[model samples]
Target: MSPLASLTTILTFISVVCAATSWTTTPFNPAAIPLAVRSPYLSAWLAQGAGNALNDVWPTFWTGAIVGWAGFINVDGESYVFLGDPDVPNASFQKAVQKSFEFTSTQSVFVLSAGPVDLTATFLSPVEPSDLANQSFPFSYLALSAASNDGQPHAVQVYTDISAEWVSGDDSLTVNWTTTVGDTITHQVQLEDQTVFGEVNDRIQQGSAFHSTLNSTGTTFQTGQDVVVRAQFIQNGVLANTQDTDFRAVSDDWPVFALAHDLGTISAASDPVIFSIGHVRDPAVEYLIANDATQNRSLFFWSQISTLDDAITTFLQDFPNALARADAFDAQVNADASQISSNYAGLVALSIRQGFGAIEITLSKDASGQFNTSDIMAFLKEISSDGNVNTVDVIFPTWPLLLYTNPAIGKYLLIPLFAYQATGQYPNAWAVHDMGASYPKALGHNDGNDEPMPLEESGNMVIMTLSHFQRTGDNSIITTYFDLLDQWTQFLITDALIPENQISTDDFAGSLANQTNLAIKGIVGIKAMAEIASIVGDTARSSNYSSISASYVPQWQQFATSSDGKHLTLSYGNDSSWGLSYNMFADVLLNTSVFPASVYDMQTAWYETVVNEFGVPLDTRHTYTKSDWQSWTAALVTSTTVRDIFINSVFKYAADEENSQPLGDWYETLNGDVEGFKARPVVGGHLALLALQAVRTQTAMPAV
Candidate 1:
């Protein structure tokens, strides 16, 4: 071959590589993307629509606090931004290409090109629920990999930044950061002043610091108001070559009190920090390279006699296996959901992430010593402090996921509430609405009122208890709380048949007297108690409660059912008004036979007519709807066609931009806009219907 021809061929190959890697400036509009979804404190998400601007909309803690921004890609002498703002145009991007994005339960990958170099940034958190170590890890991995799409050589560099706000409760505090370089580069940042932990609402933690490290050779770590990390990608190799880095973010004194509540000042100096870290592998690396790499790349040994290093070392070694479990979980959920309907599948996928993601398993221990065993008597945080654990109403919506996914995990949620009641902290004859105490600080009922929900909460407790028993076929949990359930069920027997003005779960819509739906819940709760009684061999109580429940059904129907029989009146003695007695679906779910199957048919038909373009209104009182309840109602329809109609209506409502704010449990059905509440775990309520269907169909669900 002629020398001139060889030179031309090589140049052509390089240009093609550059063209493929060249960045395409595409519009960014994601409803929301999950990142680092380990717990309430560790959970983070990136709101879409920022469009090539990383800092445009800062990453948010599930609580809605801005954690920081961490996305940027630079190649050779040119800069093309894959994440955040691109301040400078890169020669790399002079010729544009395409960008692609992929998201899964545990990972999100973004691929962008700048000239001949292709860059892919992956955000991964190992959230296998069965693996306590991986699920409890505080760190998420941010991996950056680069390669030459074409066949020629190219140069590349990448940078990422995180703000000091991550560790600061407020900007008024002085910010200071220090840098340490060993085999890896680490940057630690914190506020100069620290405070002890206390019980408070909407409170952010203080007295904590974050340690972020870049795990790579030739890494540069810089700190200011925001810390930045840069790494060398490639020098002079085939543009087809690759380079990337492993990044870790850890907060010392996490859970600031360590769930110990020692009472001595809960400052960093006094309390032990919760230790957790994550590990990741680059796909670009071959098995030989990975196998030969240092096994203990990111372990931190702070104490002379501590085995923190070994613990982390073992975890990092087993990281890949944990990730495999996470993958299987995602696949099973995705497949199971798809069988219901496309919209149902989408809802389930998002619901699983948003609903389960909001819960934080704060601590795990048993009857043994504090650090004795790994058996997790774990407590889940409600994300919003106001809706803390065992908020019966809140748990009502969030039950399906736990019940269907892992009944054992569901038991963990209720055990704490039962323990609190057993302590006599809750001395009420009737069930309280919540375990009392705002998140992470459950001493007793903290709603600051006596029996706030009265009928509503009592009914919720009895009904969910029955549900737990049905799902697991284990009466131990029900038997353990039998007396309490009996008392609550007895309360329902008195006040529920014809409810007085009292708050229900839909308290935001205001209290209503003689609420027909609340009455239905009462009847259902009584029936549920009957089932639990039967489970525990209390045949006499079971028969008596069953008869009482049966009698109430006719009385309720006489007053609450519309004369036309098309829909139920919103309240008793108000035949002209209407609302969703979605509670009726429970009768169908429990196969209780108290309400005839024809009743479900009648309500399903009625709901179809009441549905607007967005969805069916919750009741005649307003055009607003609760998404979770809507899902339950939709799932009640026996006909697939009718069920799909309701599912699509709510799906469209959720897809609307106005309702695009992190799956609000409550929204206006008229315009598909959020009325209130977002990022709440109650979306798990949507899973109730799915769980029922799963059992009826005898379908296998993901084994937690």
Candidate 2:
């Protein structure tokens, strides 16, 4: 009898030996677990649901489009699916029982029981904050290791495949692919006709998707229709080692590239079967520079490496060291965050990957088409909102993670904004809202027609510039952009006091006049400017900015304080209206002392009284709150009890099974349901407490 036909005899015995399935989570259960989240284009997640077992449901792009990634294991003639849904019709192919799931700053691990053997699948997206080359490489790793749970030898084989759905969001798009064999076995898939810098439903319309594994013994490869390929492995414990020649639409026959490894028999854990998946697009962004000429900027990794094969080879070889670095990074973040609370640590761990996933580090090509490594810039997408590029307010909230990880990253993010505005292309006196309306395009608003959040963006720029300088102790950025910094600071000086009707970063909440929270941001911005001036040895401007900011504090208090002096109002003279004074965090962050101890105490006490099951509301106007602002509020509060209260509420919301999407920053505080927004980089603000701690530990300021 064939091996598949003979497996029926042992099916009854295998079923009886298998234990009951149960599920557990380490740290806390997140809404959707990150699978392979690197760049915005390369992100994938496994949405948590009652029926969504690891093998039962397919992994999805962050936008909820299915990206077909499937895995299977054949243990002693019995076949089971583990990582994704393979949709095999055979009655013998069973779904593996997931035992546990855990995540850290850099990796997500899922443990599953496949009959008599146990499988541990780890999805690692390296978080190299200090190492730009490794961080910029658009690849994620999937390592699968198996061992016999019955303490007996068992024949085992592992298989994984990626469908062409990963190449483009539009399933009807025609795709062509090829297989290459050398030091590594790689399958490359791409659209037949590419539209450079174009996107359909946020998935780049250009770029080749690479699914690769080392060309080693016991490994076989195949390409064909998904069902055909998956069934071949189920019937036989190995692949046909052949490529399908047809080039067709992504949805036509559901073409897939697959690799399988045969572990003859295993009593102990077998060596890991590792696969690397990445999407590569040259000339990653279209950027407008000081000369008013548009230039194509490629990913920074291309500058350091000569070829894609070499890049993949080095990346695969560096896995041991890369994983070690990521492990150390996760441990450090956990250690620092646990000092606050275990709940706080979980929040930080969940936010780290989502925060950095929105950014891409790129280098500009010179006249000869050679990438200039020195001309590097980092661009961020205002994901799931408007798709704005390098949005000042978006960066403002995301900067905490950048600041805590590597302050130089924060500097790279700012360079594009400064470079664009420095050319006098932006017609606004205040900072532009964002470099571009959509991501991967940094064309400046030469017509001065960008969205107007004059006071908001102005304050954000000044505060972030100072924050970067404070963390890195690099005064060069301050002196280099002193003129434009003064321009934005001057705008803050004019509008900060009493504040005209304008929208803040929480623009979705709508515009308000004399906004108590917005007014404080501008005031703190002026104070931050004063420090920036001092750092550059501009004593005249330093004293002037200091005097102005010092004078605005008492006036701001008068306009914003409640009748009972127990809390701050939402707007001037609105004694009955109260809101989260998150802007006060910048004062504490900068050590400006602009808002006195009484202000902190009053806000802390009032927040405790008004706290909801999920979190404190953004204001009395709505039950919804912004998680980023709530975290900033948590960092500034003097009461540790109040701090934990805020942290626990956000943590509770994140752990809610119903809140299943990549962490949304805006949600209803009453029910912990997402109100609007998802997968935003602003969730990085969740690390505010860590950034604040780092800043406070600096004993001496950098000399001028």
lDDT of each: 0.57, 0.87
Candidate 2, residues 1-704: lDDT per residue as tens digits?
33222223223322332122257777766778898999989999988742255776789998889999999999988899897876766535988998888899899998899999999999999988777888899999999999999999999999999999997979999999999988798999999999898888989989899999888888899999999999999889899999999999999999999999898899999988789999999879999877678988888888789999998878877777777888888888899899998778989999999999999998987889888888879999989998889999999999889878887888899999998998998988999999898777889799898888999899988998898888877876788898999999999999998889988888888989999999999999999999998888889989999999999999989889988888999999988898989989989988888888999999998887887767789998898999999999999998887787788778877876675678899999768789869899999999999999888885221111
Q: Per-residue lDDT for 77 in model 2?
A: 88
TM-scores vs. true structure, each candidate? 0.79, 0.95
Runs in model 2 lying further than 4 Å from the true structure? 1-21, 698-704
- All candidates: CA RMSD (Å): 14.0, 8.2
Scored by TM-score, the top model is 2
What's model 1's lDDT at 333? 70
Question: What is the lDDT for 296 in model 2?
Answer: 89
| Candidate 1: tens digits of C-alpha lDDT, residues 487-542 | 88888899878999987888877888999999988999899899989988999999
Candidate 1 residue spans exceeding 4 A from truth: 1-30, 49-56, 85-98, 175-192, 196-203, 206-216, 225-319, 362-369, 372-387, 446-451, 697-704
Against the true structure, candidate 2 reaches a TM-score of 0.95
Please report how far candidate 1 places residue 465 from its true position, in Å.
1.9
Worst 10 residues of 2 by lDDT: 12-21
